[model samples]
Target: MRLALAQINPLVGDLAGNGERILAACRQAASRGADLVLTPELSLWGYPPRDLLLQPTRLTRQQEVLEAMVQELARTMPELALLVGIAEPKGGGQLPNLFNAVALVEAAGWRVVARKLLLPTYDVFDEQRYFLPGDAAAVLELERRGQRWRLGLTICEDLWVEEELQGHRLAGPDPVAALLPSRVDLLLNLSASPFGQAKVPLRHALARRAARRLNCPVVYVNQVGGNDELVFDGASFVVEACGELACQLACCTEDLKTWSPGRHPAPGPPADAVLPEPLEQLFRALVLGVRDYAGKCGFQRALLGLSGGIDSALVAVIATAALGAEQVRALLMPSPWSSSGATDDALALAGRLGLITHTLPITGLMAGFDTALTPALGQPPSGLTAENLQSRIRGTLLMAVANQQGRLLLSTGNKSELAVGYCTLYGDMNGGLAVIGDVYKTSVFTLAAWLDSPAALPCRRSLGLPERGELIGAAIRHKPPSAELRPDQRDTDSLPDYGELDPLLRALVEERRSQRELVAEGTDPELAERVSTLLRRAEFKRRQAPPVLKVSGHAFDSGWRMPIAAG
Candidate 1:
């Protein structure tokens, strides 16, 4: 029996569009002479429908759409059976709780065989509030290739993580473990797993082990493309019953792979597919993520202040790559402390990239604020206070354009700045989405280097960027990182260099190491103490910060919730 895995991407809540995508994939799969095609978890409506599951009418609409999809599948491909993940209705007085259910449709009709037994409660998932746990395992029997095949079905979270602190004994058996007793011909697991910096290899290893332990061939299908704040890099593959990878699909793109039950698995690299360079992957992930988020959230264009510094320049480059040059408008909001080179660099970049940018000199606006506050605030604030005002004015001007043109404002601050409260609140912090808020300052330079290389590593979408060009070289590099808000400004003049700071931050914030522990790891005692202090002080700011892309094991979002008080 040939089973096709349609590893695909779907925009949340776009029922008609998602249906079209499913139809296209199923047609391609049918053309390959596959008996059955399986899509990722919730491929019909997208993953984690969140509050939409709470609305009764939304569920009704989803049900209607599913019936339509089944009718279309039955008519279009009578020989091919299709499996799709969707929200199934539970006939109870309960608040219309959601279920991760799958529909098995053939020439006859559709039947829901499996529903997710486990509901994830932690780490960006709040399934318990909306979903009711299922009670039974599913095994669908079908005739394929003149042989009777029994398929064990499971959803995304079913394969990972054991049940913890179960209150009732009637939660049924673990799905993967239960499949052993069912003795199915194949185990199909559909997932919408989000991407992290070094997580792809780990998933492949887990799938391989699961197939071997279950004593059955495992067909793993993962959702691809970007969903708001999340990018699912679909590197879906199959593992033979003997623990060898059979067929593999492309990463970060829509793809398919067909596998037969008896064939020996194809050998590849030790870690499944060869991963792209870190910078290339991150750049593609960010661009695709931003494009989808903006496009899905009902926005067409984006606007941001191009300070001509590394951060803003990178944002402009990425924005142009994401939404096209015409859709991206850059504003060079220079102040009294800004250098001529900074302005020149901004204009030069805008010209090179075919972006229309306005040189909005904020010097006049700064003078007005200074004059207005001089009497009441006593001769204008100095140091951090004055520097922050410049950022605020630039943010205000950018927001004005954003409001006028209905463009989403892009914020240009990296993780290093955000870590130590170096960014101004409501200033550079004003944005609907933060593109590179999770990226470290050092990694930013690395990405620029990748983009400037002759052999441009395969990126998802065309960037329209020069093959070999230094976006930020020694002049921008030699100078200490700065906000350029004050005279002779240097970022190190206030905080530690990013090289010294990022490690300390990882140790403290991500690794959850104490100040004493961080100091012992070759981190300066004074610097560690300072970083700890800044983290504590910046809690309020981060609390109000926009949602950042989660790329690391310990991304600073709701994932790494920290207490305000210092130990």
Candidate 2:
């Protein structure tokens, strides 16, 4: 049987739109001569529909969507069998009363074929909040042209046999192991896996393990495009029974690929499984995140404060790539303490990217703020508060430009500064979206170096950025990291050097390691304790910040939920 993977990007809670999207994919798959088609988890209402499922009439609305799909199927491809992901209601119940499920739709009609077993609660997924688990493994009997194929269907987290692979397990049944008794012809895992540095490799390892366990070709289809802070990378693939990759799909975009039962992919690395270099993967993910976030939120243009620091420089590059240079404008707000070289570098980089900029010097305004506040306070604002006033001045100017022009204001703060209490609440934090908030200071430097290298010339040219030599000129990239809020101010003055700090932040934030665990790993006890305290103390600041574009496993976005009042 010809099996088609319809990797689609669906908007959350747009039931009518999502249903149309699924129907279109199914029609396209039928046109491609595929007998069967599979879609991502929760394709009807999009994954993590969140409160949309809690609507009083959501179940009734879902039925309408299913009926619409059935009508579309009957009107178009009468013989094609399409499997769609949906939120199936379990009648009336207390608390959660739904299951993440798939409906097998044919010309006759549609019915719930399978319900997801494992409801993941960790790392951006809060499935348990809405769904009740399915106890039985789902095995579908697919019939086409007198041939019968037994295919097991699993949702996003169902195929994640963590105990066998990661040595630890989440609270769930082993979906892969449960399929052993069925002796199915093939296994299908519909996923909405988010992009992360380590996620791609880990997913492949798990796919190989499942294929080995089930002793069947495992087909994985995933959702694509940016959904809020999460970007689902649709790198779908087919793994053979012996752990050999048979076919692979594209990444970070909508893709459709097919695989036969006995077919093996052309030799060399698995096309979809060939992991990109860390920086490239991160850059692509951010670009997708930015483009989709802005597009979805109804913004055609973006504006940002360009400080000539490494953080803003990197953010400018990403924004330029995501939205064209013409659509992304920069504001150079130079305070009295801002360096001349910093202004020059900002202009140079903007020129290279063909970006438009308005240089608004805040030096005059800083004097005005100090003069006006002196009488009420009985003293001129000095020290940290004075430094932050400069930032607020720039932020207000940027927000005005963004508001007047109807553009998104992109925040440039990185993980290191935001991890601590180094950032001002409404000062530098003013923006519609935080482009690189998940990226660490050290990683920012590495990404800059990579973008300037000869390897990035193709990407630079493709994005219409100047590709003659270095894209992000050496002067801007090699300079010491600074906020330019005060004279001779460096990031090292407030926090540890990035080389030492990034590892510690990674342990504390992403790994969720305690101070004791960090000290056990040769980290200085005092330094670890200080970093931990800062990370916890800064939660309030992060709560007020813009929605951070997530690239890491644990971002200070929707996923990393922490308590502000509790220890």
Question: Candidate 2 regions off by >4 Å?
Answer: 264-267, 270-275, 461-464
TM-score per model over all chains:
0.92, 0.97
| Candidate 2 lDDT by residue in tens digits, 1-567 | 898999998988888898888888877888788899899998888876899899968778889988888887888888888888888878776879888999998889899999999888887888889989998999999888688999999987887777766655677688888889999989999888888887777777898888887788888898988988888878888878887777777777777876668666566656455645667778888888999899989999999887877888888888988899889999998878889999998898888888899999888898999899999989999998898898888889988998999999999899888999788887899998888899998898889999989877766776566778776778988898888777788889988888988999998888888999888978898899888899999999999999987788789988888989886
Model 1: which ten-residue window has the lowest total lDDT? 162-171
Residue 209 miss distance in model 1 (angstroms): 0.5
- Candidates' C-alpha lDDT: 0.78, 0.85
In the order shown, the candidates' Cα RMSDs to the true structure are: 3.5, 1.6
For residues 75-134, could you state the per-residue lDDT of candidate 1 as single tens digits? 888888888888887767876456778888676777788898877766677777877877
